[model samples]
Target: MPSILLCPQDTAVFTREYLNGWYSLSAYYASKLTSDLPMLLICPTLFTTIIYIMTSQPDVFARFAMCWGVSLILAIVGHFMGLAFGSTFDLQMAILLVPGLSIPFMIFSGFFIRIHELSAIFRPLCDISFYRYTMEALMQAIYGYDRPDLECHVEFCYFKSPSKLLKELDMLGDLYGHDSGITN
Candidate 1:
């Protein structure tokens, strides 16, 4: 966030976009605070681990499968990114920035509504969200997936897939019964 905003004008490149443009970008960086990634991962990992460990009649592997599964991983990774260098944690800025930043993303991540169906403030979040991108990635991986959904999904966006995921899922359905749910 600040990287885009706080670039020293003399040190940074400009394409005659104009002085006002540079000023606005710099102001935005000055007003931003970064979200700490390692801290965020630490908190959730502890919660999931505790929940997985504490529940009696526990199946450790099953708990991981259920709780820390692909969807959660996708969401967590998205969080690390969206908040990475997001804004300064100042209360004054945070007061507006926190809700301004997150509530919309929460609403847009398809947990609340489909992309085509959003309204008001939420509509913008959908347009800009990395979560939306990541969600598409997850949907692609599991859907019509090959034997490699695990590797590709955990590695997340690193690999490029030229094949359509739905096509893979469709082909998989032919080779294996769709009802088994074992392809993933």
Candidate 2:
């Protein structure tokens, strides 16, 4: 909606007539950012509320904080995507490419496949992937700090600190400390 309404026409008109120069890209970007803010904030906030309630996730505040962060990142990426591909056909191509891009990130997320099992070259991809950070932060938010005790069968009893599990998966829970209180 934003791109369809603002791009290639309004952007040209505003840049040519209003700003006195092409420097209005910032203004254009800001306009899109502001216009989308309400849906961007409301959808994630409401979705987080529903999912957290259903899952009974502890540290609701922290989880909501992380969810909001992820949503904002997504919105920023989406906004840039519109700017990157100004034409409708190009935008459609970018949308088609999203799933292709997501597959590697999903593989490296440590949920679909263990991070340790990934080749050394692929490890860096996991580090860069927002999905990996999102998953790690959510996991740390759920299980960090409190050190919950669980009754486990003999084999599973070896499972200990959530931090240790994070280490085993090569995700640094400490990294998201400020973002979602994943650590102190």
Best TM-score among the predictions, by candidate number: 2
Q: Encode model 2's per-residue lDDT on 81-157: one tens digit a residue.
A: 55555544444565565556667777777788887887898889877666676776666655565546544557755
For model 1, residues 90-183, the per-residue Cα lDDT tens digits are 3345345645666666667764577656667567777666455444543443332333332343545533342454443222233222222334
TM-score of each: 0.34, 0.68
| Candidate 1 off by > 4 Å | 1-41, 50-90, 116-124, 130-184
Q: Which candidate leads in lDDT?
A: 2
Candidate 2's C-alpha runs over 4 A off are 1-23, 59-63, 78-89, 150-173, 178-184
Query: 68, model 1: CA deviation in Å?
Result: 4.2
Candidate 1's TM-score reads: 0.34
